[model samples]
Target: MKRLVAILVIILILIVLGLLSIWRLSQDMDVYVSRIDTIQQSVEQKSPDLSLIAQTRQDWENEMQLLTLFLYHSALDEMAEKWLEVELFCREGNYSAAHNTLSLLRQDWEQLYFQELPIPQNIL
Candidate 1:
């Protein structure tokens, strides 16, 4: 019947949209991961660029405004805390601690990134 067809169409559209969002978010996450990698490299060099730290955090905050629409806040909570620690360590010239925090943050980011992929483990 017409009602049944319409419902099926709507469901199909929702599924397609969900797939698109996952693909787009995964791409954005890759950018975020690379951004952190650059910061870690800079910190490893003993430069401790507070400006870069501030800029990256600012960029992340700006992006989160849109990202929040699709992501659960709980998933981001730990990374948010780690980011603050990274900023503090950089400001205090504690590159070693910053490096460690970045590693932890990287793991958190990877967990989020992989969770969205269309892998067997994630799908099954």
Candidate 2:
């Protein structure tokens, strides 16, 4: 009876902790996604700036350290590839290609962000 109550209490605590973890991860990923959106907007301008593209890539590389802990490696790998494509397009003065790649990168970020949610469908 006391043992059963204790077990239930512990289980409740674990569930709360899990939910909190998901919330925190979602917030962090949201920030990254927002930043990507800002970069995307910048890239879509008439004359996209190469310097801004380089800076955004560097920012993403820095974030990868903490992001890798919560996100899947495959997602990260694909994001890295997209970043490379964006950089290449920017260097080649192909603003349209760079914008398209940035759009794909943003989509990936959004997908990863939602993947952190503790959805019942995901579990069952």
Point to the candidate with the largest lDDT. 1
lDDT of each: 0.75, 0.69
Which is the leading candidate under TM-score? 1
RMSD of each: 3.9, 5.9
Instruction: Specify the poorest-scoring 10-residue window by lDDT in model 2.
Output: 115-124
lDDT of 2 by residue, 31-112 (tens): 6676667767777775666676677677667666555554445776778778879889877878898888888888787776
- The TM-score of predicted model 2 comes to 0.61
* Collision count for each candidate, in order: 0, 0
Instruction: Please write out the lDDT profile of model 1 over residues 19-56, one tens digit for every residue.
Output: 66566666677678888889999999988677877777
Q: After superposition, how far is residue 53 of candidate 1 from its true place, in Å?
A: 1.6
TM-score for each candidate, following the candidate numbering: 0.70, 0.61
Query: Which runs in model 1 stand beyond 4 Å of their true positions?
Result: 1-21, 116-124
Error of 2 at 121 (Å): 14
